[model samples]
Target: MAGLERQLTLRFLAEPADVNFGGKVHGGAVMKWIDLAGYACAAGWSGKYCITAYAGGIRFVKPIHVGNIVEVTAKVIYTGRTSMHLGVDVKAGDPKDQDRHLTTHCVLVMVAVDDEGQPTEVPDWKPELPADIELRESAIRLMEMRKKIGAEMQAHVDLQPSLQVP
Candidate 1:
């Protein structure tokens, strides 16, 4: 997948506005960037509006400093009936050094929607390269883990009154 079309990369400079009181880029800002990149990848592949269904495995490896060059990459690793699983990576480094390192990583699930906001089927993506195949397998494992977590949470939802819907 050297020339894969189901991927999007967004590069920009980390500014003061993105920094938190601790002088590092806010985690919320990085998450927003991840969602934007994932949304672009999902919509580009499906040619339809996509909404983020789930975001998991988000790990902040390093702090992003202001004035660093930030790069966020999102790639579609697997596709289901109406959902696309994307791997999002955020990297940043000083502009002078130009050596970027991974600062954050996550997997996002996006669902394609029709004009009426109904979930719609997306075009199937077949992994052709070895790396792509491995990514697809990873996505499958993540999906299973997510399912288990969801089930466990659901089992305890009734025990927490604050979690119940009004």
Candidate 2:
């Protein structure tokens, strides 16, 4: 935490519009928050406007109520030449309560782009603290998982026979 200066923790209350009829916050709304946090953290780290290239391994561990105090944190755990892997965690609970439960966790890959929308290089990040090192390793493993899932999805699409171009 001391070495990683480019991190952000955004705290706010979930609004009624973020909730669904089931009386819980919508997953899409939470995802939108995650993307926003990731974008901010990545952009801060890269010092350039970044676009979300991929997001995966999203875990919705608990539910968030409409009026819950939402705590969203995003950090650049790893970085490539042009990409920054961000770990975004979202937690929610009552403002009066002492315990805030973890609601969602995700990995977002954001790529810096130039004026032409082409990928541009970003500064490298090296993990310093033990927790940071663990996060960096976790990001590497998650990237592998993303590649595996992407390959499987491509294979499945190739197997589908709906491409008869007349």
Candidate 3:
């Protein structure tokens, strides 16, 4: 493969439709944007269709108001055999002011898929910058934590119900 394209940035205005009852852009709307940006970044890097396998550490740092310019940036930080780990950041600010602040951040794992919808190999990503290296390390650490969290969740699922339903 040629030099890998490792990042994708999407920019748009926060619309009134995205507002929640709290009068800020809804968290669900931000999540949808994160997924779309992550998928695009993964697909571009892998040169195949992709699906989101996991999203973690989603932090809502600030409320995004309608009419603010929103930017969602996804960077491919690490790659497994068939998975791409993306660091997605969402920011918004008044278009008139031309200043943006991070409103949300998360890590997402996307898997490339073949025409049959099976997992497919993705191009390897090498960290060329210090920031890239740090993000890659963070992804690896998150993967380790995911394993422990998964086990705990499975243990909970395996437990018998304490309360009987009518």
Candidate 4:
């Protein structure tokens, strides 16, 4: 399925103690930003409430310290009956240094739900337009990664071989 793009920006000063430790931002804090940004992207596309089902390929490329404004951009790359794949890129630097380097990136899968809290269908995405090439590529890569992870997990489960009850 095809999806859309959404972005959110928060100045470094807005981040408080929850994200800072010894004047440096924590990894968990960075993850929170990813999730929030991804959610917004999914909601913007789905036009409804979306819940995070899974997040993968989370990599921390750099550390964000106190007083560094961070910008997070998220986009929906794929959509399904009730699920959407969102990609989030995080960067940090002084406002003056607009060249902000990428600090982290990840793909999150979210499912749209109705007010009754049940999964709901969303419009299918079509990437025939040239502008959607990037999003389409991202979704393809995410799908590939998900397949690999699923295979590894299955292998691990097979190795365990559950015991039968008496």
Candidate 5:
């Protein structure tokens, strides 16, 4: 249903503290903002506290300099039995300029939790609009890719001499 958007946009300035030695914001700091934005969106949608279950590959496309206006947008693109996949994008630009540079983009899965901190069921999200449908399809494709990558990584781990469980 195309109703209230389970989305959140956070705008802030990249302070010096957020910057690294190269005078650019650290990737981890941006990721934290992304996670927080996702959490806010997930909590609002599920009506329960949500935790980050997974954050997909995030590659920094451009460096965000200190004093730049940073904008992060997180929106629920797809939902499963208990999880929501949020597509988050980070952009930054000078206040005087109209251009907003795309810094990174990633898909995050947030799982709702109960009072006891256990995973709880969340409402399903049905895509109606064309953009929403496209996002949902992308989410499913990303999920499958993650599964395959996880399996491949696990297989490699199993071959490691020091990583054996037994």
Candidate 6:
């Protein structure tokens, strides 16, 4: 089903605090924006408090200079019992330059929570008419990838040696 789209955009002015000595926006700052946007989208979609559980395939495609306007678009791609997958795309460019747009895409997994701050199932989802086929396909692929990654993480944890102090 074609899911919901929610976006948050901000013009990040690179102050010295946000930039490195090399004069580019810090990756950590960009990552913070990404996570915030992702969570905002998730909360809006689920109409409940949501926490980020996973971020997949995050790549910084280009660098942002001091005056670049970063636009972040977040959307609900899929939903499970208590989890929702969000796709966030970050673009860096001058706001005046409408022609320049480069996509920095990342997928985030978020879980809805109840008023007691416990995990809760998402509300019923019914796709609107005239859904986008390509978007649905992409969301499906992402969901599969997320499941595979979760399994791998569990296996890795299982393999870790336990330390027992004598």
Candidate 4 lDDT, tens digit per residue, 1-166? 2244344454454255745546678888888888888777778788889899998889999888677778888876677789888778888888666778888988889899999999998767766767677787878777887889899999999999579897
**Which candidate order results from sorting by lDDT in descending order?**
3, 1, 5, 2, 4, 6
For model 3, the superposed segments whose C-alpha errors exceed 4 Å read 1-3, 162-166
Q: Write the per-residue lDDT of candidate 3 for residues 24-136, one digit (tens) a residue.
A: 99999999999999988998899999999999999999999999999999999899999999999999999988789999999999999999999989888889789889989
Task: Write model 2 residue lDDT over 1-166, tens digit each, in one string.
Answer: 2224568989999999998889999999999999999988888888788999998889999999988999999988899999999989999999998789999998899999988999999988998899999999999998888889999999999899897779
**Tens digits of per-residue lDDT for model 5, 19-106:** 8888889999999999999998888888888999999879899999989999999999999888999999999999788889899999
- Candidate 6 lDDT over 1-166, as tens digits, reads 1224444454454466778777888888877888888887778777788998888888888877767777777776667788877777888777567644654778888898998989998754544545534555677887787789889999999999998898
Query: What is candidate 1's TM-score against the reference?
Result: 0.92
Clashing residue pairs in candidate 6 (N, C-alpha, C atoms within 3 angstroms) = none
Q: Kindly provide the TM-score of model 2 when superposed on the true structure, using C-alpha atoms.
A: 0.92
Regions of model 5 farther than 4 Å from truth: 1-4, 163-166
Question: Cα deviation in Å at residue 73, candidate 2?
Answer: 0.4
User: lDDT for every model?
Assistant: 0.93, 0.90, 0.93, 0.78, 0.90, 0.74
Model 5: lDDT equals: 0.90
Which stretches of model 2 miss by more than 4 angstroms?
1-4, 163-166
> Between 4 and 6, whose lDDT is larger?
4
Clashing pairs in 5: none
TM-score of every model versus the real structure: 0.92, 0.92, 0.94, 0.79, 0.92, 0.79
What overall lDDT, based on C-alpha atoms, would model 4 receive against the true structure? Answer: 0.78
Off by over 4 Å in 4: 1-23, 128-131, 161-166
Better of 2 and 4 by TM-score: 2
**Model 6 misplacement above 4 A:** 1-5, 8-11, 124-131, 164-166
